[model samples]
Target chain A: MTRQFLRHGWTAGLLAILALLFVFTKIIQPDFGTSGLDSLSRAMLPFAFATAAMAVVVIAGGIDLSVASMMAVAGVTAAVLMDGAGDGMTAVAVVIVLLVGLTMGAINGALIVITRVPDIVVTLAMLYVWEGVALLILNGPGGSATPWLRELIVGPFIVPWLPRSLVFLAVCLVAVWVPLKRSKLGLSIYAIGSNDLAAYRSGVSVGRTRIAAYAVCGLFAAIGGLTLTMSTGNGEPIPGPYLMASVAAVVLGGVVLGGGKGALLGPIIAVIILRLVRMDLTLLSVDPNVTTIVEGTIMVVVVMFGGVLAYRGRHK
Target chain B: MTSETTMFKSVGRFIGNNPLVPLLILLLVLVGVLEFMRPGIVNERWIGNTIKFAIPLAMLAACQTLTMLTGGIDLSAAVAATISAFVMATQVPIVGVPLAICIGLIPAIMIGMVNGFGVAVCRVHPLIMTLGTGLIATGCLQVYQRFVIASGSVIPDGLAWLGTGRTWGLPNALILFVPIAILIIWAQRRTGFGRLLYALGSNETASRISGVRSWQVFLALYMLSGLIAGVTGLLYVGLIKAPSLSLVNPLLLPSVAAAVIGGTSIFGGRGGYSGTILGALILTVLGTLLTLLQMPEGLRRILFGLIILTVTTTYIRLTEQSR
Candidate 1:
C-alpha cells in the first residue's frame, strides 16, 4: 500500500492542490458556493474535452494542431442541426455531428499516411481548412439548440450545484476511455508513440493505431463542441481558445511531448488549476494584461520546477 | 502514344532528380497564370515587390528550417517576433530608432535564451518550451504595452527604406537580405554549428556518443532562431508600416508551411535554406494568385489547405519514386 501510494504520489498532490485552490477561491469571494463551482465546471468543459482530445493524440506519438478547428466545426454543425429541432432530433443531430468529426479525423489520418508528410505540417494546414469550413457552414455566429437540449447539457443535474455536463464527462470517462485505455489498440498507441519502427517490427500496425487515436480525438472534440454550444446557447465558428492551451495542459499533465507516457487525471487537474488561477486573477481585480502574464509565468515556473525535481530524482 | 508516354516519364525523371525544380516551376506557373489573368502584371517593379514581401517570410522560415533540422521547433518565434516589433515600435519615441530597435531585440533574445534553457537544461520538449516561452513573451509584451502605448511610434528611416525602397529596379531589401541569405545557406553547409544541427536532429544518441555537446548546440541554435525571428519582426513592421499586437503571428503558420513546401521535413535531419527561400517566394506568389482570383475568404482558406496537402504529398511521392 505504501509503495502504491508513493508510485502515485503526484496524483494525490495535484488533487490536493486543486482542493487548496478551491479553498483559496472561497476565501476571497465569500459568495462562492455551489453556484460558483457549477459555473466553473461548465466553463472548463470545452477545454477539458479538448485537453482529452489532445492527450490521446500526444500519447499516440502525434500532435493534432487541428483539434480546436475540429471542435469549432462540430459545434457549428451541431448548432445548425439541433436548432429549432423537434423531439428526438437533437439526439440524431448529435450522432451526425459525431460522425462528421470522425470523418474529419479519418481524413486527417489518411492524408498523413498517404502523403507521408509530418503530422505537424498536415494538421497545421488542416487547422486553417477546418476553420474555414466552420465559417462556410455558418456565415456568422447566430445558431442555437433547443431549450431542453441546452438544459440537458449545461443545466443542473440531480442537485442544483452539480452540472449535467460534468456528470456527462465522468460517465464518458468510465464508459469509453477506461475500456479503450486497456484495449490492444490503446497499448499499440503507446508502443508506436514510444518507438514506431520497433512497434512496427513487433507487429503493431503503426498507421492504423495512429489513425484510431486521432479518430478518438475527433469524437471527444465533437463532444466538447456540443457542450460549448449548449452552454453558451449559441455557436460561433471561431476556434475555441483551447487550441494551444490544450497542448500546454497536456504537457503539464506529465505527458512527454515526444510521446508514450502520461495520464488523463494530470491534465484534468492542470486544466482546473489553470482555470482557477485565471478565476483568482479576475476575483483579485488584476489587470487583464497582468493576468496573461501570471498565467504564462505559472506554466513556465511549474514545468521548470518539475524538470528540477525529475533531474534530482534521476541523480538520486 | 508510346512516344508521348516515354517523354512524360523522362520529364518526371528530370523533375524528380532536381528537387527544387517543382517549386520553381510552380512559382513560374503561378506568376504566369497571374499574368494571363491580367496582362502586364508581371513587370520588373511587381517582381521586386513580391521579392520584398518574400524576404521577411524567408527569414522566419529560416528559423523553422534550422530548428526543425535539429528535431525541434520554435513555436514561440511568432510571438517573440511580435513582442520585439511591438516593443521597438513603442520605444522609438523615447530611445530613438536604432537604440529602440536594439532594445526591441533584447526581449526576443531573452525569450530565446529561456526557450533554449528549458529545452536544453530542463529537457522540456522544444515544442512545449517554445510555446510556453512564446506565451510568456506575449504576456510580457502586454504589460510593457501599458507604459509605452502613449508614446507615438516612429518607423526607423533605414528599415522603411530597406523594406520598401527599390534600388536600380531591385528591392532595396536585397542589400541586407543578400548577406543574410548567403550567410544562412553558406553556414548551413560549411559551418560547424550547421553540421551539428543536422547531426543532433538526425540522431541525438549517436551525436552524443560522438562527443558532441547537444545542449550547447540547442542553446546556440534557439538563440540564433530568436535573433532571426526578431530581425524578421523589425523588417515586417517596416513593411506594413503598422505595428499591431499580432504583427507577425499571422505569418507563423505560413512560415512553417513555406518550410515544409520547400522540402524541409518537419521530422528533421534533411532540408536546406535554399529550398526554404524558394518556398517563401512560391508562397508569396501563391498569395498573389489567390487575391487575384478574388475568391470568398472561406473558399480561399480551404483552397490553401488543399493546395498545401496536395503539393506536399505529390512532392514527397515524386521524390521518393525517383529514389
Candidate 2:
C-alpha cells in the first residue's frame, strides 16, 4: 500500500497545494473562516462532481465531451419539474432528472459501442444534441428549485458549522466511490482502460465495462446539476464553459486523459484548488479576463509536467 | 448476367478505391434537392452566396484535415483565426491593409508552433494541448476587448473587397478557395512532405525507424493549420464586415463536422481534402435549407447534431465494410 501511494505521488502533491491555498486564502482574508467557508464549499461542489464524472469515464478509457451538456439538461429538467409541479413532487422530479442524465450517458455509450465510432466523436455529437435538448426544454432559463430541495442540498447538516454540501460530498465518497472502487465492475473498468484488447483476451467484457462507466459518469453529472440548481436556484442552458472547466480540472487532478491511471482523491483536491484560485483572483480584484489565462496556463503546466514524468519513467 | 455482375463489381471497386467519389455524388444530390425545394437556390446569386459562406468553413475544414492527417487535432483553430482577425481589424486603421494582414498572421502561426511543440516535444495529447491554447487565445481576446480595441470594429474596404467582391461574375471568396484547393490537392498528391505526413500518421514508430523527421513534420503541419486558420479568419472578417470575438466561435464544431463528414478519419492516415470540399458545400446548403424552413434555433441545432451523427456513423460503417 505504501508503494502504491508512492507511485501516485501527484495526488499527495495536489493535496498539499490545496492545503497551502486554503491557508493563503485565510491569511489574505482573516475572516474567511466564517461565511466564506460555506460559500467556498458550495462553489466547489458542482465542479468536484464534474471532475469525478470525467474521471470515471477517463478511467474506463473513454472521454465524454457531453458531460456539461448532460448537467445542463439535468438542471433544466429538475428546475422545470420543480416549478411546474408542487412541493410534494420534488422527490419525483429529482428521480426523473437523474434518469434523464443516465439515459443521455447511456445513449453516448451505446452510440460509440454499437457503431464502432470513436468515443470523442460520439460524445462530441451528443454534446450538441444535449445542449439543444436543454435549450428546447427551457428556452430562456427561468425556473426555481423548491425551497425544501435547496435546504436539503445546501442547508446546514447536523450542526451550523457543517455545510450540507460537504456532507453530501462525504456521502458520495463513502457510499459511491469507495464501494465502486472495490467492486468487480470497477476493476473491469480499470482493466479495459489500461488495455481493452488485453482485457478482452482475458475474458473481461470491455463493452459492458465501458457502458457502466458512462452510466456512472452520467449519474454524477446529474448530481452536479442538482447541486447547481440548489445553490443557484436556477438553470442555464449554455454549458460550454463548464465543459472545458471540468476537462481542465480532470487533467489538473493528475488523471491521464488516455486513462487507466490516477485516483478520485486527486481530482477532488484539484477541483478545490481550482475553486480557490478563482476565489483568490476575485479577492485580489483581478480582471475576470485574467481568470481564463490563469486556468489555461495551469492546465498546460500540469499536462506538460505529466508528460515529462511519463517520458522520464519510460526512459528509465 | 456475368458481364453485368462484373460491371457492378468494378463500379463498387472504383468507389472503394476513391473515397471522394461518393462524397461528390452526395454533394450533387444535396444540391439537386435544394434546387428542387427552393427554385431560387438554383440561381447564380444564391449559388454565389452559398459558395461564399462555404469558403471559410472549407478552409477551416482543410486546416482540420491537415492536422488529422498527422494523427492530431487543433481545437484552437477557430480561436486562432479569430485572433488573427482581431489583430488585422484593429491594426488596419493604423497600418495599411498589407502590413496589418501580415502582422495578424504572425501570432496565428505562433499559436500553431506552440501547439506543435507541445504535441511533438512534450508529447501531450492534441485535444488537451490545443484546448489549453484555445482557452489562452480566448483569454487574450477578452483582454484585448477590455483594454486594447473596441468591440465590433468594421473591416477595411480593401479587406471587405477581398471578402465579398466579385471577379468575372464569380465571388472573390470562391475564386480564392479554388486556387487554395488546387494547391492543397497538388501538394498532397505530389509533395514529399505530404507523403511523410501520411506515413507518420500511419505508423509513427515505423516512419521514425525509416528516417522520417517526425517532429519537423508535426511542427510544419501544425504551423500550416494555424496559417490557414489565420487566412480563414481574415476572409471571415471580410464576409461579416464586423469581426467580434464571438464572430467565428460557432465555426469550430462545424469545421470538425465538415472534415469528418468529408470522410477524413479522425484517427488519421486515411483521408484527403477533396471530400472536405464537398462536405463544406453540403453543410452550407443544409444551413440554407434549415433557414428556409424557418425552424426554431433549438430545432435547428438538434437537426444539425443529428445530421453530423448520422453522417459520421454511416461513413465509418461504409469504410469499415469496404476494408
Candidate 3:
C-alpha cells in the first residue's frame, strides 16, 4: 500500500487539492453535488481536452502556444460546416473538423522540423495565423450548436450520477489517451523529450516523435473546440485564453516543463481545481478578476513548493 | 572568374560578420516599398511618425532582448507596462503626476523583484514566473481599478507632449529616446554586466562553477526588465491617449517577434539590440503597408502573420548561409 501510494506521487497530491476544492465549493453551494457538478463537468470538457493536448506537446519537450488558436480554428471550422446541416452532415462535419485540426497540427510539426526553428517561435507565429484563419471562417461568430450536436453533447444524462460531458471525457481517455500512453509513439515521445541527443543516438527519430506529439495535440485541441462549440451554442472568433490557463494547470499537475514526465490525468484534475477556484470566487461574489490572481498564485506557489521538494530530494 | 568569386566570398564574409547591415538594408527597402505603394508617404513626416510608433514597441522589446540574452523571457513585460500606465494615469488625478508616476512604477519594480526571487532564488522557470507574476499584477490592477474607476483618470501633460509633439521635424520623444537608446546599446557592448548576461546564457552551470552568483544577476536583470516595461507603458499611454485594463497587452507577442526577427536566438547566447531596432521598424512599415491595402481585418492579420514568418525564415536562412 505504501509503495503503491508512493508510486502515485504528485497525482495523490493533485487529487487532494481537487478534493479540497470540491468540498470548499460544496460548502459554498449546498446543491453542489448533482446540478453543480453536472454544469461544472460540461464547462470542464473543453479545458480537459485542451489540457490533454498541452500535456502531449509538453511531454515531447515542446510548447504549443498555438493550442488555443488551433481550438479556435477547429471550433469555427465546425461551426461553419455544421451550420443548418442535418444529422448525417453534422456527424460528417465533426469528422472533417477533426481532420482539419490534425492536418494543421501536422503542418506545425513539419514547419518546426523543416524550418529548424524553435517550437515556441513556430507556434507563436502559427497562433496568429490560425487565429486569422478562424476569423476568416467565422467573421462574427454564431453558427454552431445544431439541434443534433446540442442534444448529443448536453441533452440528457446517460447515467444516473454522471454527465454526458464526463462520459465523453472518459471516452477520450480510454479510447485515445490510454492507447497513446501504451503505444510506441508514447515511448518515443518520452525518449526524445528526456534527452533528444541520446534518443537520436539510440535511434529514436526525434523529428517523427515531435510530429506525432503535435499531431496528437491538434486532434485533442479539435476535441476541445468541438466541445466548446456545442456547450456554448456558437463559435467565438477569439481564441480563448486557454493557453496560459492550460500551461498553469499543466505545471500544477506536475508535468515537468522541461518535459518527459507526467500523467495526463493529473492535468485533468488540476483543471477541475482551477475551475473550482473560479467557481468559489463567483459564489463568494468577489470581483471576477480575483479568480485569475488566485489561479496564478496557486500555480506559482505549487510549482515553487515542488521545486523545493525536488531540491531537497537531490541533496538527500 | 577568380576575382568575381573572391568578391562574392568577401561580401558573404562582410554580411556574416555584421548581421545588422542586412537588417538595416531591409528596413530601407521596406520604406522604399511603402513609398512606391503610396508615393510621398516616406518623407520626413513619415519617418517621424514611423519612428514615433516604433519607439514604444522597441523599448518594450528591450525587456525581451535583454532577458533572451540570458535564455529567459519576461512574459509579464506587457502586463507590467499596462499596470504602470493604468496606475500612473489613474493616480495622476489624485496625486501629482510625478508622484503618481513614481508610485505606479513601484508595482512594476515589485513584480520584477518577485519574478527575480521566484526565478533566481526559488529556481522557477522564468517563463512561468513572469507569467504568474503578470497575472497577479493584472489582478491587482483590476482590484485597484474598482476603487479608482469612480475617480477616473487623466493623462499627464508632459507625457502627452513627449508622446505627440514634434520639434524641427523630429519627435519630441526622441529627446528621451536618444539617451535611452544610446545607453542600452553602449551598455550591451561596453558594460561588464552585459558580458555577464552573455556568460550566464552561454553556460549557467559553468558560470556558477566559476563563482558568479547567478541569483544576483537574475534578480537585477529581471528587475531591470520590469523597470523598462513600466517606463514603456507610461510612454505608451501618452502616445495612445488611453488607459485600459489591457492597455499594452497587444504588444507582448509583437515584442517577442521583433526581438526574434532581429536575430536574437530564443535559446539564448546570441544576437544584439541594434538588429532588434531595425526589426521593429520593419514591422511598423509592414503594418502600414497592410493598412494601406485596406483588406478585411482577418485577411490583414493573415497577411501580417504570413509576412512576419516569411521575413524571419528568410532572414534566418540568409544569416545561416552567410555564417
Write down the C-alpha DockQ for each prediction: 0.65, 0.70, 0.71
**Residue-level lDDT tens digits of model 3 in B1-323:** 99999999999788888988878888888878888888887789988999899999999899999999999999999999999999999999899899999998988889999999998888888888898998888898898899999879999999999998899988888887778878888888899888888888899989989989999999999999999999999999999999999999999999999998999888888888887888888888888988998677888888877777777888788888876
**Candidate 1: which stretches are off by over 4 Å?**
A1-3, A308-316, B1-18
Worst 10 residues of 1 chain A by lDDT: A168-177
Each prediction's number of clashing residue pairs: 0, 0, 0
lDDT of 3 by residue, A1-316 (tens): 8888866778998898788888888787887776677788888888888888999899989999999989998998888888889889998999999999888888898888888888888888888889888988888888966786776656337565677778778887678888888998889999888999998999899998899899999999998999889888888879897898889888888888888888798888899888888888999997898877887898889888888787777779
User: Looking at the true structure's interface, with contacts defined as alpha carbon pairs within 8 Å between chains A and B, what fraction does model 3 recover?
Assistant: 0.60
Ranking by TM-score: 3, 2, 1
Assess candidate 3 and give its TM-score to the true structure.
0.97
**All candidates: TM-score:** 0.94, 0.96, 0.97
| All candidates: interface RMSD | 1.4, 1.3, 1.2
Highest DockQ scorer = 3
Clashing pairs in 1: none
Question: Quick one: ranking by DockQ, best first?
Answer: 3, 2, 1
The residue-by-residue lDDT of candidate 2 on A1-316, one tens digit each, is 9787777788888988888998899888887864676788888888888889999999888999889888988888888888867777998999898888777878788888887878887888888888889899888777989988787656577787788888888787667788898999889989988899999999998887888889889988998888888888988777736677888888888888878987788888888888889898888888878987897888887898788788888989
State in Å the error of residue B22, model 2.
1.9
Model with the higher TM-score, candidate 1 or 2: 2
Clashing pairs in 3: none
Better of 2 and 3 by DockQ: 3
